[model samples]
Target: MWKCLERVLCLNCAFAFAIILARTGASPVIVNGALGYSVSLSPLTSVSQGIDEVVWRRLSPRMKLARCSQGSVQYFNTNYTNRITLHYRNFSLEIHDLRKEDAAEYEVITATGNTGNEHSELFQLKVYGLVSGAHITVQGIFGICNLTLICTVTSGDPTFTWWRNGEALVNDSTQHIRVLGNMLEVHHAAEVKYAVYKCEASNPISKATAEIKLRDVCKLDTSDPLPNSSICAEFQATRSSAATGSF
Candidate 1:
């Protein structure tokens, strides 16, 4: 709870400063990165109060600074320049051909038009890499027509892709993935149709996918380890039997 509040406060403060800079006709900019995402940094108040100069810095493993007036300044690290592009008008920095090392915090500094009214705001940049190790399962039955779908990724990026019979499954209006960590949950599973299901992890450079085939309750081979089941002991049999009877 405290951590959440801290984040909110920090965001609000950054916004307030951006507002003050806009009102003063001060240069305000937002620095962030995106591969498939289109993000913009808007002056929180659109009123540049006293800010005269705006600067954006990339802070990850090392500090790379860029000036609003000058396109690029001397950077402590050399790797960022080739991958980073600056947009001074909106105070944004776009990272191209992202890499895993690009994940970290960034900064924005504003100098007020007056002699000594300067302040700085820091923003965080996270680079998501290619994801891997995905599995899918079905559970939670409501009726002959109701069920649930669950997709799990053991590691890698948070993004997930659900496929049925080797084709991408279209999520329904009522379907949503759980944002708690990286778990993907879909409610209201299909009633009778069963097929090969897959979850693919994606990032900038490559993708890895895991697949599982779902059979009917009558044809499902409970004789073998429930696909992807880690349980190797007879305990799996006992547990499966007990649960099957109850349901």
Candidate 2:
């Protein structure tokens, strides 16, 4: 809990400092990247006057990425060879085709020409991959008509959204629909008929989807007709346009 609070306080301080700079007409930028994408961490505005040199580093691990002094930019060690570049004028660092290992804290420090006072700003980069899978499964009550649909995945930090027949599925007070995390619970035979529940998972880079065709699972066989419930009729009439849905 203390670690969590520290992280929150650290982020809050970062944002507060950024806002202070923006208010003073010097707004630095934080860059977020994804796997296989290129990123550049540059200041949106110029640094303070009398600044003569700049240095960049991975602030947390204290790894030097680049240095800019006397109008020249220098890359550090071989760990960043061929994949990192530094801009001499502003000391911005360019990362080519980002990877998970590249995620870390970064900072740019400015050296004053005469005032002897140094200023610095921070930039933190986070890299993530596209969401994968979203495999859905039906659990229990194959004959009783009550069920739960579970959505799963293999990788990536993802946010999930639930859909029913292409419409957003929210909690229904009648106990017919219930959504929690990646699970969707259904009760009543009418709720099980003529519906399709879709689970969409997404990360910074891309989206993936999976679905449960209620008509297929609810009915015993393809030859069997749909239930004659009013709710089922309504769902059938409002068919979803998810013909090409894929995982």
Candidate 3:
């Protein structure tokens, strides 16, 4: 009978411990970090006096990052050696020289000695590359309808934004303008003859802008013969002009 009673007590204690853990759980907060940069994960609640220990951990592929107790800090995991800092006052964790592999879910647990209570906070880290080399490329004839200007970037996952005459452009069916992901299509090319168009590409870390002028791209050579001229003569004339200019 005593053995059965002891078993019942153990089961009750296990159930109570599960409830305590559930109450201390928290939703993960998203934190954005740039590659090769440093980012800090702050605790949701301030560390109070009489707290005995603070433990920082990475959840996935579980690893203990650091532990603090009695005004002393202990570092774990050779992967994070010399790259992490634990602030005593606030118990915030700072990771330096962030890498793509550093993106993961982190947890901070604080335990109070007197009360034997523990609280935990979670953070989800996301790393992004810097935006660079953004430029605009044109398609179709300059004077023709359905002209398209495409925004291209050399690196980074970026969002595209279009601007015309310094004003933000959006999808306006009335104006015959469409703003697709990285392409800006204008059904009426004449409407933009005197306007300057700009394409801005950006990510969480950086941004770049490129501009274009329709007049410059569509400039015509005044020296060229009229459209009515014979094709054979036009080719010969153009070759002769180029030969004379070489001198």
lDDT of the candidates, in the order given: 0.48, 0.67, 0.73
Candidate 1, superposed: residue stretches over 4 Å from native: 1-47, 59-62, 70-77, 130-156, 159-213, 216-247
Query: For model 2, how big is the CA root-mean-square deviation?
Result: 11.4
Worst 10 residues of 2 by lDDT: 236-245
lDDT of 1 by residue, 1-247 (tens): 9999999999989987777764454433323333333333333321245455666565555465565543333333467566555565555555556555665666666665656555555555544433445555555322332334555555445565666555565444235333222233443244534445466655443456656554443333456545443221111000000100001
lDDT of 2: 0.67
Model 3 residue 56 distance off true place after TM-score fit, in angstroms: 0.6
Q: What is the C-alpha local distance difference test score of candidate 1?
A: 0.48
- Tens digit of per-residue lDDT, candidate 3, span 104-162: 99998888888776777888998877677777776654324556878887767789888
Question: What TM-score does each of the candidates earn?
Answer: 0.42, 0.66, 0.74
Order the candidates by TM-score, highest first: 3, 2, 1
By lDDT, the better pick of 2 and 3 is 3
- After aligning candidate 2 to the native by TM-score, how far in Å is the CA of 217 from where it should be? 5.5
Across 43-143, the per-residue lDDT of candidate 2 in tens digits comes to: 53354465677878886678888887777778885767888887765567788877888888777777677865466677778777656756777665444
Per-prediction backbone clash count: 14, 0, 0
